[model samples]
Target chain A: MRRLLPALIALALLTGLSLLVGATNLFDSPLDRSMVLAVSRLPRTMAAILAGAGLALAGVVIQQTMRNRLVEPGLTGTPEAAMIGLLGVTLLAPGAALLTKMSVAALSALLGTAGFFALSTRVPRRDPMLLPLVGLIYGGILGAAALFIAWSTDLVQFVGIWQTGDFSGVLRGRYELLWLIAALAGLLWLFTDRLTILGLGEDRARALGLNVRQTVLAGLTIVAIAVAVVVVTVGAMPFVGLVVPNIVSRLWGDNLRDNLGLVAVMGGGFVLASDVIGRLVRWPYEIPAATIFAIGGAAIFLWLLNHPKAHAHG
Target chain B: MIDIDHLTLERDGRVILDDISLRLPRGGITAIIGPNGAGKSTLLHCLAGLLAPRSGRVRVLGRDIHHIPARERARLLALLTQSPGTVPRLSVRDLVAFGRWPHHRGRPGPTDHALVAQALERFALTPLAARDVETLSGGQKQRAFVAMAYAQSTPWMLLDEPLSALDPKYIRDIMDRLRDLAPPRHGLTEAPAASRSVLLVLHDLQIAWRYADWFVCLKDGKLLAHGPRDTTVTADLLSALYDTPLRLERVSDSSVILPA
Candidate 1:
């Protein structure tokens, strides 16, 4: 009961802010005020919520499976790898459907994450701290691969696909597919306890009757798909995954099930807030979601360095 | 029963365990003791299926430990490694509840809750049920971890240096609890139609002498001696295992002292 009040207040504030942002307009729409509401504000807000929730949920699960506090979808290179896939398809096919593009991105993301897991497990790399370091390196490698391909093909526009995260481009037709990804994130919530057990370390997980390898693989797979869709739909929101889940954990507890639900809401709130700030900071001109998140996230990371939340939440 | 046949473990260029063959009958506390680098923990890890031996086989209950499905293997055995980092927000009950991961896979049912509650109570952690594990003292965290492994409800429990940093009282308490659980009394010794055995990598020779029913001693990555504690507790063998002169003397009615 004591904890309930604060959470409710936070929720209400987020919802109110989201609505307020939904009402703000960039264009004096030739179509009218109602058109802007139905078209731009509504769908973009929904996509931001869905993408935010999905990425944050993925971060929570990945953190659990990897048993590390610093890990996030972007750090592990899944989103970067997915962007590479999207860049390839967007440049080459030029006519690929959203689903086809998502599939390609998902596959690439899985491969990237699996590669990270494989290297960590097989190479006597016991430093859990180094896991994220390795991930950053892996992501760098993939990011470079993508840039090289895009540069060679002269698809400079495609190269910017993952450079920033922006919900402004999310229209109803293209953004609705993210709901499928979000739904899958919801489904993964069913096994939150399993991911929590995996966090206890692999041997304990196995002893408790969890398929440790499978749980980890499955968890990573979910993160891959969620991040792939997030990348394809909304571009790469770097620390949104890292920040929202970490905050949710500090506020709540380590029960992944509870954290998953809370993070989805919190993540949506955080991204929506940033999106709104982007609108206001330079109204009508608008800012990229990733850029806003980058500035906000770096501040949060610096704050976390001073008052560590990973230890608090993890 | 835990059986290792011709097990060979290697790291870098050095062999850790060379053709080591052993069987731990279910249902007693077995201590694996050795000097600084005798591969005690290595053997324990191989037996737990956390590490696959370079060659040979480890069969826990007539099933290849590594080959067995991970979830089923977890249901059968639990491993407690040296002082793993704590999850900051996890309460004692929540920590213990993780033992049921293999059983519940996250959708913890009523039985899982009951088991967690029981484990917390058994370990005298009911009071700290809501306190974060990270805030607990070293001894308290060890107790929490042990309770978690117990909550796993597996027939076999493998611990590496569980007694490190614990005071004598906590050590005795833990040993007494495990002794009570070791077969013919509690259900811990009921594995693979045989005695339920607890294999531990121990640094304190006295603890090994006082509590361990069986011993597996290693030296220079080789099996030096193994048997019932009484048979293998000689000072000469102990000294050889450590590459130094060692002595085991009765210090008190309830304690044995080994000169470090």
Candidate 2:
């Protein structure tokens, strides 16, 4: 409880600041103020928080199921697969409802994640670095395929918008699909113990009577839905997943049931802080949250690579 | 009690365990001793229901093991693999607590907590309970895993080379604990009526001879010999089993087998 207080406070402050920092002054015009808050500011704030929380939760599931810390939905080609699905749907039915696009994207993300899991089996476990490298190459191939399809269909600009995460475009109705992440987050919490047991390896988890295959598939599907929602709504939030969960696991340990709330709090706080900073850095203009996160996340990831503590287990 | 009837397992056109059958009775420590490629670990996996034999059946405590619900089967048997993978940043206590998963299924009660505590104390892991398993020494990590299996409170334990990579002291420590968990010898107070029946795949013949009450030897995925350890295990049998010349000699109260 003591540990959570400060994070909660920080999240509240960032959320408040995110709601107040846009172009329109909140106090100057009461009528337009509440309208702006309702239409754009409130939705943007919620989108950042939900996407962050969902991605972090997804990262935990992916890392635990694959037994690798470096792999996340982005690294495993999830967002790229989602992009391919979105492109396919757009080509097939350009006027499809937002929910239809999200469902198709989620299904493709699941398939892509499953493909990454299948490839992971052939990689030797001796080198911890090898698996992530394989994931990177796999993601690279999928990303290239998505790019080619986007080029052929003349949807390259649309693909570009989905590749970098930004909250500026988020509006009242446009961002509600990200609420699915709230449900996905609940689903992840329900399976926290199973996911933690999965990190102990398939044989040990089986010995403990966990249905390893079902638990893994469930986890991957949750990850897919969470990533798909984020991709469809706010674009790919690069290392928010990789960085947030790693940090939380480092400080709090890997007992998912115990640390999941913290992961969610810290993740929501991190992205909210990023969005607020993005608003402030250019004043009236804005930088994408993905760019800011990538800068900070890459530094943390590099430090994690060289950190002596990481070598203790691997 | 456990029964295997003509179990045969094949992987990618290669036979692992071929038409092998054996019965392991309840109580006491039963050691499966074999050379490399003897399917010792594979056989243990089959008994634990982690592997499905291509043909034949395995029955545990009167019910077909594979047919039993996974959670029910877990309650009946706990397997400690040779190389239990590490869950990063998991505390020793949390790792051991997972043994009770089948009992509570994620909602641990006070009884589960008490059992986890008892398991930690039994394995002398109370002092290190809060420590991350990843930071523990190899022997300590092995002890923690054994404690987890012990915490399962199952009637049967199937271990695959629990003593592998351990120093002599750790080996003796584990074997002694396993021996105590098995039914006591005459004049000694038995562990309990519900003491575990241990079946382990062993590479250390000396340790197996010292601690195991029953022995099952395998060679090339086939049953070589099995019976009471004192009768079935001999210099000639071991020599033929390993395809080498060896002799067993009594050294004071204990016996040691060596090259002839």
The candidate that achieves the highest lDDT relative to the unseen native structure: 2
Where is model 1 chain A poorest over a 10-residue stretch in terms of lDDT?
A22-31
Q: Tens digit of lDDT per residue, candidate 2, span A1-314? A: 55678888989988888889987778886558888999999999999999999999999999999999888888999999999999999999999999999999999999999999999999999888898889889989999999999999899998999999999899999999998988888777789899888888889889889999999999999999999999999999988888998988876688887788878888888888788788889878888888888887788778875774632111
Mind giving the per-residue lDDT tens digits that candidate 1 earns over B1-260? 78889999999878999989887777788899988888988888788778878999999878899888777877788889876755546777778877887787656899999989988888889888888787888788889999998888888889989999889988988888777767432333444453345778888877788788788988877888887776667888887877787776766565455665
- lDDT string for model 2 (B141-198, tens) is 9999999999999988889999998999999998888887886333223335578889
Model 1 residue B251 distance off true place after TM-score fit, in angstroms? 4.9
Name the regions of candidate 2 deviating beyond 4 angstroms.
A27-31, A304-314, B184-192
Fnat per candidate: 0.63, 0.73
All-Cα superposition RMSD per candidate: 3.7, 2.6
Candidate 2, position A120, lDDT: 95
Q: In model 1, which runs have C-alpha deviations exceeding 4 angstroms? A: A1-31, A119-134, A308-314, B54-56, B59-68, B86-88, B183-196, B250-260
